[model samples]
Target: MAMAADKPFTLLDRCPPSFEKTAQGVCKLHTRYDQYDSIQGVGVGGLTSSLPARRDGFTPEQIDLGRYLFFDPLLSVDSTHSCASCHQPDKGLSDGLARSVGVSGEEIPRSAPTLWNTAFLTSFFWDARAKTLEEQMLGPLYDAKEMGNNPVQLLASLNANQQYRSMFKQAYPAASDDITLDQIYTALTAFQTSLISLNSRYDQYAHGYHQALNQREIEGLNIFRSFVARCAECHQPPLFTNQQIAVIGTPEPEGMPLDIGAEKTYNAPKLKGGFKVPTLRNIEKTAPYMHSGRFDNLRDTVEFYTKGRGHAVPEGVEMNLHWHIWEPNLQDHELDLLVDFLKTLTDESFMPPVPKDVPSGLTPITHTVQTTTMINHSNSAPGKGE
Candidate 1:
C-alpha cells in the first residue's frame, strides 16, 4: 500500500456544475450550492465541494460495515480501544487530549488529528506520512502503541465471528469467504471519507447569508483575511488548508525527542519539524492546537502566531518563512475578533451519534457512560504522557 515514488498527487479534477476552473487552473466551487442554500439562506455554499467518489465499487452497505468496525474494540488486540476512542465524533473526530492514549495505555507520539474533511486531503497524518487514506488507516491498527492488532489474528477473529463474516460478505459480495486486509482498509477509508464538514456560520456568511455573521464576527473575518493577519494564506477557504507540510519551528515538548515530522517519511533533512497543515473547519472543537498540542486555547494559539514564535529557527531545522509574515502588532480586541471568527467554523451538524452497542460486545469507547468512567479513572487521565 506504499505510495510509489513516481506517483503524482492530485486533487479531484472533475468539475461539477457548481464548480468552475479559473484561468490559473484552480477550480473553485461556487458559494451557492442548492443543498447548502436550503440549509441557510441564499449564498450558503460549501468550502470545498469535492465529495469522494466510490472506490472499488463501494456502496452504502460497506460504509455501514466500516462504521461498525470503526467503533468496535475488536479491531484492537486488547479489546480496549477503537478508532472512535481517539477520533470521537463529539470532539470533532479528535480526542480532547494533547496526545492520544493508545491501547497499551501509553501516549501516542502525536495528537489524534481530526478526520473532518479528510476526503479532500492528498496526504494523511500530521507528518503527511501516509500518501492515502488506506495507508493512514493501517498505520494505527498495526502500531504497537496504538491498536496493536496482528493482521493474521485480526482477520482470523473476524472470520471466526459469524456476525462479522456476514457483515463482510454483505459489504463485499465479490470477496465472499475471503476477507482480505485490503478490504478492511477500503472499508475504513470509505467510512472516513463520509465524514465531511461544511456547514458552519462562516460557510453561511461565505455563501450569501451575509447576516449570518454579527458585527464582531464580520470584523474578525476581515482581520483573518486582511494582510495584517493573513490567516487565509495557509488556512485557505473551503477546505481551510492548502494540504501542505511546513517547518513552522514549533518547539519540542519537554522531555520529548524532537519530532522531525514529514522528514521521517521522506528522509529529507530540510523538512525537519514540518507537519501537515490541518483544516480549521472545526477549530473550536478540535483542541489543543498544532502537531504537539502546545496551546490549549484558541487565544493562546493566535498570540503565539502574533509573536512570530517560529522566527528563531531550531539548531538543525530550516524555518518556513511564511510563519513570520503574520502581523505582530494586533491589538487585544482584534485578537478576540480573530478567535471569534475561528469559533464560527464549528458545525455541530457534522457530529454523528455513537451507536448504542457494537457487535463485538465490547463497551463502545465513545459511549458516554464508558467515556465518563474512563475520565474518572486515574489511569485514564486525558493528557497523561507515555
Candidate 2:
C-alpha cells in the first residue's frame, strides 16, 4: 500500500518566503504555478522555468519551422551537428555522456540537460548563467563547438529557403524583414518552451492516485523525506528542486579538466564547486548525470550522494556550503527502493517527435550513429579488448 494512503499527506505548510507574505506575493505565486501547471501538468510548483514565458507563443507553422531548425545540421558551420546530436530525444533529451562532442568532434565541457520542463526554470545552464530561455537559446547557436555557425551564415541559410520565407510571413505578418537570426532563435525557443513534461508516475502519486507507485517506491519516498537522505531540503516540493545554486563536490573525472562549475559564470566568491541543482524529474532517462556528466547510472549517482565526494573539497571547508553529510552507508534494498522511486519521475508524454517537414523546407538530415554505446571511462574501461 502507498504510505500516504492512510492519511492526508502534509506535503508542506511552512511560513512562505518573507517577501511572499503579502497578498501580491500570494497572487504572484498562484499565477506562476498556474501558468507552470498549464504548460507542465506536473504536480509540484515553483520558479523553475529559466524565466517567465515571453508574450509571443508559437503557431503551428512556427512549431513546424522550429522543429526543422532543431534537427538541421546545416545550421552548424561544418554541417556536422544539430541540436538533436547532443540532446537526443530517446536519451531523455540528453546525450547520455559526460561532456558533449562539438561539430568538429572535439569534446567540450558540460552535459546536455533535458529541455523537458525547462519552461519552468527561472535560470538556465548548469551554472545558472543565462537569465532567460531566450538568452539561453543563442548560446549553443553560435558556440564554436556546438552549432558553430555565425548569425550571418545562419540568416543566409534560412533566407535562401522558400519554405522559411513563407513560414516567416505567416509567423510575423507585420515585419517587412523576411528572416533574421533573432526570428530563428525565437522560433526554436518557443518550441523548446512548449516541450513540457508531466503526467509521470510521481505526478499521479502526488495527485492522490494511490496506485501510482508500488511497494518499493513508497518506501523510497519515506527515506527520501527522512533525515537520512534529506533530498527534500534542496530538491523540495513540486518541481523537485529549490531552484537555488549549490556546490556539491563532484570530482573532475580523469582526462577531463576541472570545470569550475559556477565560478566561470558567477566568479570565485560563489565558490569554485557550485553548480545549479537540477530537477530530478525524468531523471532515469537523463543519464551520464551531473554538470560534468560524470556518473553513468542511478546506482552510481545514489552512491555518490551517500558516500559524498571522495577527494576534492569546496574552497573553504568551514563554510560547509552545499556539502551533504549523508548516511555513512546505505543498505542494498534501501538503494533499490530509491532507484525505483526515481523511475516514477519519468514522463514519456513530454517527449517531442522529430518534425516530418521543416518550415524552412529542409529535409531532416540522418546520421549514422552507434547504437547502445557507453562512453569509455578510464576508471572502468578494460585494456586492449580485455
Candidate 3:
C-alpha cells in the first residue's frame, strides 16, 4: 500500500492499540523518508508518533470508508472477488495459496501476499512494477487474470450502490456531490495503509520481554542476522524488508510461464527472472514463499538461502546459484534457528474488524465455496477482535 503522506489528520477510536505509541530508542525497524536522505533509500515522514491523532495519517471517516471498499465485491468484474478474497485475514492477510483463483476462476500466477504493514512498502507488486500503492490499486481491477474490471466500470458499480453513496459523502464531504475514481483510490489506499502489523512475539522480545521467544527461536534470529545468510541485507530487521529489489534467480517450474525481471529498466534487453524481496514478517503463517510461490515450506526457504541460492559451490562458480554470499556448510540446527526466529514475526492482531454496516442495506451476493467469505465478518478466525 502507499505510504501515508507527510500531512497529519485526526485519529480514530478504533486504531490498533499496540501501535498507538511511538517508543523512542526502540530500535526503529523502518525509517522515515528523510531518514534515507543520503542516496535515495526508503524514507517516510508522516505520523510516526504514538499519539492516536496521527498514528495512521488517516481520519476515522476515511478508514471506515476504505474498509467498506476493501470488502466490496463491486470492485470486481463479476462481483465475486473483492480485495479480501485473496488477501484473507486468517491466513496472515494472505490467502495462503501458491496461486490465487481469479473472478474468472482461473488460477493466477503468483501468490497473494499479506496486506499487513504494506504501507511501508517502497514499491508494489511482486515484480515491483508499481511505484506507489495508489498505482498498485489500479493493478488487480484491470488485470485480465485478476479482478478483471475497468476502472470506469468499477467506479460506476460503486456509485450505483446506495450504501456506497452514503459512505462517499461521509468520507469526502468536500467532494460529496461527485465521487470520482481518485476519491475511491484514496479511500481504499488509506484503509490499507492503516493495516499496520506490530506486537508480534519479536516485538515483545525486542521490548525486553525475555520470554517472548524460546531459545531455539533466539538462535534462529541470530542466524538470520549472520553474514552466512546475509538475510538482513534485503530482509532487514524491524519491517524485515529493505524495500530494495534483488534477483534471487528462483527456478521456474516446468510448465510455468516466464517473467522478465526489470527488462523494462532500459530500452535494452534484460533477463526475465528477477522479483521483489517481500517482508518476512508473519513468515510462518504466510507460506508458499517467493514471487512465483515456488517454495511451499519455510524449511525449503532456509535451505535455499543456506545454500546461497545455489550459487556458492567450490571452484565451480557458475554452477552455484548464489555466488555473492555462499557458505559451504551451515548446520541443520542453524537452519532451524532461522525458521524459529521467523515465526516470531507473526502479528496475530493485524486484521481489522469489519464495520457492522459494511453489508447493511446492500444485497449480499450469494457465492459458492470457491468464493471465500468476508474475513472481517468471520468470527472463527484468530486475530479478529475489534
The TM-score leader among the candidates is 1
Q: Residue by residue across 334-361, what tens digits does model 2's lDDT show?
A: 8888888889889867465675544433
State which candidate has the highest lDDT: 1
Report per-prediction Cα RMSD to one decimal: 9.9, 12.5, 9.7
Cα miss at 12, model 2 (Å)?
41
Count clashing residue pairs per candidate: 3, 10, 14
- Model 3 bad stretches (over 4 Å): 1-56, 265-272, 308-325, 355-386
Order the candidates by lDDT, highest first. 1, 2, 3
lDDT digits (tens) for residues 156-196 of candidate 1: 76766666666777767778587788888887876676675
TM-scores of the models, in the order given: 0.80, 0.78, 0.77
- Model 3 residue 147 CA deviation in Å: 0.8
Clashing pairs in 2: 44-238, 48-120, 48-121, 49-119, 49-120, 49-121, 49-122, 50-121, 50-122, 50-123
* lDDT score of residue 294 within candidate 2: 78
Worst 10 residues of 1 by lDDT: 1-10
Whole-model lDDT, model 2: 0.62
Model 3, 132: alpha-carbon shift in Å?
1.1
CA lDDT, every model vs. true structure: 0.68, 0.62, 0.61
Better of 1 and 3 by lDDT: 1
